[model samples]
Target chain A: MDSLLTLLPMLVKMAIVVGVLLLLPLPLTWMERKIAAHIQQRPGPMRVGWHGLLQPLADALKLLTKEDHIPADADRRLFAMAPVVALVPPFLVFTAIPFGTPVQLFGQEVTLMISDMNVGLLFILAVSGIGVFGTILAGWSSNSKYAVLGSLRSIAQMISYEIPMGFSVIGVVMLAQSMNLSQIVAAQEGLWNIVLQPIGFFVFFVAGLAEAQRIPFDLPEAEGDLGAGYHTEYSGIRFSLFMLAEYLVVVMLAALNVLLFFGGWNGAPPFVPEPVWFLLKVGFFVWVFMWFRFTFPRYRYDQLMTIGWKVLLPLSLLNILVSGLWML
Target chain B: MEQAFFLLLAAVAVTAALLVVLARNPIHSALALVACLVQIAALYVLLGAPFLAVIQIFVYVGAVMVLFLFVIMMLDVRKEAQVRFLRGPLLPGLVVLAVLAGEMIALLLHSTRLHAVMGPGQPVLEQPSVADLSLLLFQEYLLPFEVASVILLVALIGAVVLAREDGASAAKAARKEPRGAAR
Candidate 1:
């Protein structure tokens, strides 16, 4: 009975995190559109509700009310499962992320995380990678040439960039000597790991952008060529799910960059509190992501591959070497 | 409770493994492989090696399997085509599978004996935490790790060369005059 009572608050926090992540994508969609509109010197989403504060809510309602369509030629089972597959991984990755330090609740010290597995970083990477399967499945199951091509491109782009992304983190892992996010943040007490591993940080930033399929590296979803890319055939709520997953990926990437490179939840003054500092740091990266989207043109597919392989890969390897030497 | 959980994981692993082998569609096979890998990771967690489990999921399930699914999908292999089974050498294939199955079953049954040989009632060693694993990987496994890097470099170079060869061949084909023009 005591144990059950102790577990209740932890479960409640877990529910909140899941709910917040699900709801986060809605506002992110509005923000992205508004940012793009503002950059182009146009008014955006003003009529919906208080500069379109309720725009996402309206959009969600519309998508919910829309008809769910499944093409006759499509692989029925996989097509149905793809969106769920895509959405689950990002949500699951949120489990290991420590939003705040452990607090005493009902005489039990419970951390504000769904789970703090020993290999939290790797678990996040693994689960996030699984999200690619959904994209691939959606593309293939659509039975359209454009969808298949787009999905192939996405998979290749992700795989190519992931090598550098993983390699880039090798330096940080070396410096901190840990895969645990909390420990990594704690190690950055006096000075952040980013100070010592600037090359790794840069490589990770670039690779992460590519992994998230943001502009500049978004060749898979290149509107000029592949139409809507992997989700070309998807419509209604299915399309919304894919869109939500994309924005969520953007948020996840920013959050991960904050946790990995920046001192997560740690600030100089210590007055701002850890969670607030974490959110601010994450917000900074999110803004940078938006800025990049506005500023840069998309790279040619070959160019993207070349930069990932020839540039980021070798640079990450060198960063790892330098980190090792520095440690010695 | 632990036994039930372990049994559930085992069931998932076995079912997924069978699906990977038996699925008519390559895409389905890949998904099954992902399921099998995830279940294996769960088993690794039960065995008190959470780090190994995560790495297993990360490297094999995440990176490698995604590549496999990508290749399979890109090739657009038709699921309707009947797989040519045991075309010439049925006996050898069966023998090989039998041997493999026998070894797997033997290992499963004798694992307890093997554990006893290591020591009776000896505590199962706690795996090094993520921090310790990183330290040991750098300190002790440095040589092998560097060797792995070299191997990856070689593979990267090979892939580049192969890609260039294909590009050159395509360019040559494009440069050739039309056969009708020659006529």
Candidate 2:
């Protein structure tokens, strides 16, 4: 009973997080459309409700009602499994991220995060990397030339960017002398990592953009070229599952950026709570992500590879060297 | 509870390993291998080595398996359902499996270290924290760690050298053809 009582807060937190993550894409998709439209001097989806507040709801209904189809020659089992495989890893990543400091609940102190594993940073990186399998599986199982080519390009892009992304965090790890996300955040009480390791922040942000497959790194889903790329054959909820996963990744990256570089919940404004502060910072990054999506043109495939390997990789390694010298 | 969890993980790992060898499609084999690696990582976690478990997933499941899938996909390797994997009498394979199982049983039954430390009723060993693990890795086993890294570096360089030779030959061919010549 004592153990059960202790587990109650964790179980509740998990429920809340999972609930929010599922519903999060609704608002995010609406936001993306509105932003993209506004940027192009247009009112987006105003007919749905009050400047299209209910647009995402309508979209969700349509997707839910749409007939899901599997291509004739596609691998039936893997085709059905791909979206689910893609959806899980990003959700698993949330388990390790600290939302705010612990709070008292039911006479027990409860952490905002599900778990604060000592190797939280590494665990997030590792688990998030596994999300690639979903894309690869979806593409390969579709049994189409476009799907295979798109997935192959995506895999290459992800693998290339991951090296720089991994290296970029080493500077923060060195500065904090810890791999725990909370510890890394706490270490930045006096000064944020971005102030000390600006180059690291830049590299991480760029590599992160590529990792999330946002434009101009969105060659994997180049609609112009591949007719919706890996998901050309998918329809209805399966396609929406891929979209949901993408949005979740964007949220994950935004939250991670705040935690690693923006001092997480640490800030001025004593009246505001810590979690709100974290959310505000994360929201700003999310906006930046959306802004980039609408603003930048997609990079040519070879250009994307060159930027990842030639530019970002070298820059991250150099940043590590500089950070080490500064720490010394 | 821990014993039951370990047994579950071991069962899954063994099954996944079997699937990896038995699956006709190369991609299926690769995915099965991934499942096997993940189960092994879970076993690592059960053994109280979260760092090892995470690295196992990160490197093996995340990076290495992606490469394996990439190669399999790029080459368009598909189902060879018609081909027999073990194209001979089953006797030789059965003998090998029997001998391996027998050796394992013999080692478990007779090894003093196993009996002293890991046998039933023996207390479990204390697990080292990640900090302790890293300290031991960097301080006690630094030379071996560095040597392993060097070995990996050599392999990487060898791959680059091999690729460079192909590039040079391609470049020579391009030079001989000249710009905008006949098809």
lDDT at residue A235 of model 2 (Cα atoms): 95
- The top-ranked prediction according to lDDT is 2
DockQ per candidate, 2 decimals? 0.78, 0.77
Using TM-score as the measure, the top candidate is 2
lDDT of 2 by residue, A1-328 (tens): 9999878888999999999999999999999999999999999889999999999999999999999999999999999999999999999999999988888877778888999888999999999999999999999999999999889988898899989999999999989888899999999999988899899999999999999999989999899999888888999999999999999999999999999999999984889999988998998999999999999999999899899999999999999999888878
**Model 2 docking grade:** medium
**lDDT of candidate 1 at residue B20, scale 0 to 100:** 82
Pairs of residues clashing in candidate 2: none
Off by over 4 Å in 2: B79-82, B113-129, B168-183
> Per-residue alpha-carbon lDDT of model 1 for B86-153, expressed as tens digits?
45778998899999999999987788877677656767668658666668889999999999999999
Model 1 lDDT at residue A302: 89
Interface RMSD of each: 1.0, 0.8
**RMSD (Å) of each candidate, 1 decimal:** 3.2, 2.4
Residue-level error in angstroms, candidate 1, position B32: 0.9
Q: Highest DockQ among the candidates is held by which one? A: 1
TM-score per candidate:
0.89, 0.95
